[model samples]
Target: MPTKSTRVPTHASTPVKRRPGGRSARVQDAVYSAVGKLMATQRPDQITVPMVAELADVNPTSVYRRWGDIDALLEEVAVAAFTREDEVLPDTGSLEGDLREWARVITDDIVRPHRTRYLRAMVNARDGVVLDACPCWTARREQLAEMISRAHTRGERTPSVEQVLDHVIAPLYHHVVFALPADTAYAERLVDDVLSMRSAESR
Candidate 1:
């Protein structure tokens, strides 16, 4: 087994340019970047389109017209941010290793710049909207599909998406959402417990 590396990854993800429609793409990038800058120091609720626009050097009308409101902008930015994060999830040989490594990386992300804004976006996501509406959720599923497929290649079965989320991912998110102090050790324990339960259930 490959021992876990102690290297802490910097969570400063580059903002993706969303919306590929020419000037629209530029506008989206500027808006997303503006929101990211604000989110670094202020909660999403504490930010306004005017504030974002002033920081982005765009017209407030453009911000309002494109995103409609601060809530939508934050959501979009959150999804974009998560996409960047997910792009780095490693493909370790074992499903357990893959998840444990993923969890450890995100455990460090809990303290990154603008971490609170993204966590609030994720926790508040399912309150009134479809959880799948968030691009981050979709990105995670797609990544899992690939991960699971790799496990199958090694003749190993993997947990269902729901199981993975409920047992592993959700618990880590809880730490962030609740502002609890947890490190990757918490992630390893959570994964170990969940895998143990799954093994017991299978027997």
Candidate 2:
């Protein structure tokens, strides 16, 4: 039997801090846009801080002061691009429905060409950082926790967070990172497999 994967960290260990508005926000937005545009035409490995600063029309020092390094900037940009901060979590009245809808949304988003590029860029930017340290992974884990909490309140049988991460989330990301097929059906199947664990536990 496969041992359960460790729980993903609920939050980033070192969150990026920035002033909300005024000149600082503008500069950050420009830098993020510059990175997005560059990633469209250039590999993340080839892009440099100077290149980003030049494209954003900001001084190289500003980029460095804000993000410190090209890899850090890329990771931040990728995280910002991937997360929908304003979007509400699915509340479909059941864990199965919620997971299916959530999985479908994730499958649709990550499988897009631009998102695929960002996912690849995020992976390259990490070097060898554990998944627990990744802001993107932490965000997804938090979302999953919220959904699972709702299920628990409703007295629904639910799989542990580790089981969901291992059976559902991990497989989807594996397919994506490996350039294999990861469609809505595949995502839903993973959800089904994880939910089966809940059934097994009850039996």
Candidate 3:
């Protein structure tokens, strides 16, 4: 439960190095770093390959060669941000505890800062031709589904796993990240309410 001041790292972009694996890896790193920094200030729609190339000090043609288009570049940035191993929920042998930790992690990591940026990125992707093509949404949906499945296995949730996924967890994430209220006490209350519902169903 870190305060807002202490929560976000000053440098939000976790830049990966140009891997020596090959030229493609290096070029991709350049593209991701460039897009990530730009995303910090501007919405995803504002990011273009030329803008990224200028920021990364690479040729716009080079950026296009690696990523094809702005949508592709933004997709890569979303995958890197959302699908990282650290973003996955821990099993923790108890659904309630695991979900509590999950909520807290998301609250601090994704919701603390740049909430609008992340939400706008999703919106932009959805309104474009690259909706299903984005791996970020796919991975996150799978992760959420898996968490619900684990709760079902433990007999910790009711009204079907799909119900909880749709009505409970999904809505909570939407509320916390997209419609971020200035008052986080409400966020905590939502988390607690979800956890309590699962606990009650378990018994």
Candidate 4:
């Protein structure tokens, strides 16, 4: 835990150590990795620079000089976690099939103890603003929308792909992330509901 005297670094003060040489970006990545591991177990409020430094096996001064404070460090950590390879979007031919795959992929991640803990923390802290701000959100949503568009190209549904994404799949996913029971069957049911909605809309 940071002491009162340990000032939280301003967002501006938390300069990313990215330089033209790439040396600083590497260092910044290491720090963010350490913080991600910590976030798996601890809430953002409990994360500290010393703990991150210890995990990265770098001196505390290096952490401070690079990231400035724990909050900035935490933000970077969240960003890195979001961009990790496990979250990459997959392509399948059909909208329903793709959505089922997406639901499975998403739930598999959310059901993990580490990720669920972090997600629960974010949800409890406030509506999923932290997750929403992640760059991956836009990227993943776009990919999903593209999948939905492919369904439209096939004449699979009446509502536009964007409507399905915004109304059905997105809301279901949000519930899965923030509120729904994290069961495989439950996830499948959500996918079913989205597909049913699409079919009805088409009718």
Best by lDDT: 2
Question: What residue pairs clash in candidate 3, if any at all?
Answer: none
- Candidate 3 lDDT over residue span 1-203, tens digit each: 00111111223334233333566556656666676678778867777778888987888998777668787666556655654543446788776566556655655655645644755576666663644333444554566668767877886653334444554456655765566452345445555666556443345
TM-score result, candidate 2 = 0.83
Model 3 TM = 0.68
- Model 2 segments more than 4 A misplaced: 1-19, 198-203
lDDT of 2 by residue, 1-203 (tens): 00011111121222233435678667876787788788778877899999999999999998998789998888777777655554468999999999999999888878876667778888887775776445666667888889999999999999877688778878887888789999999999999888877443455
TM-score of each: 0.80, 0.83, 0.68, 0.66
Clashing pairs in model 4, backbone N/Cα/C closer than 3 A: none
Ranking by TM-score: 2, 1, 3, 4
RMSD of each: 6.9, 7.2, 7.2, 8.4
CA shift of 145, model 2, Å: 1.7
Task: Write model 4 residue lDDT over 125-174, tens digit each, in one string.
Answer: 45335443434354455666677677788876634445555654556447
Candidate 1 per-residue lDDT over residues 26-118, each given as its tens digit: 676677777777877886668888999999889999999977878877766665556543257678789899988877876776656477567
State residue 34's C-alpha deviation in candidate 2, in Å.
Answer: 0.8
| TM-score quality measure for candidate 4 | 0.66
Model 1 per-residue lDDT at 163: 68
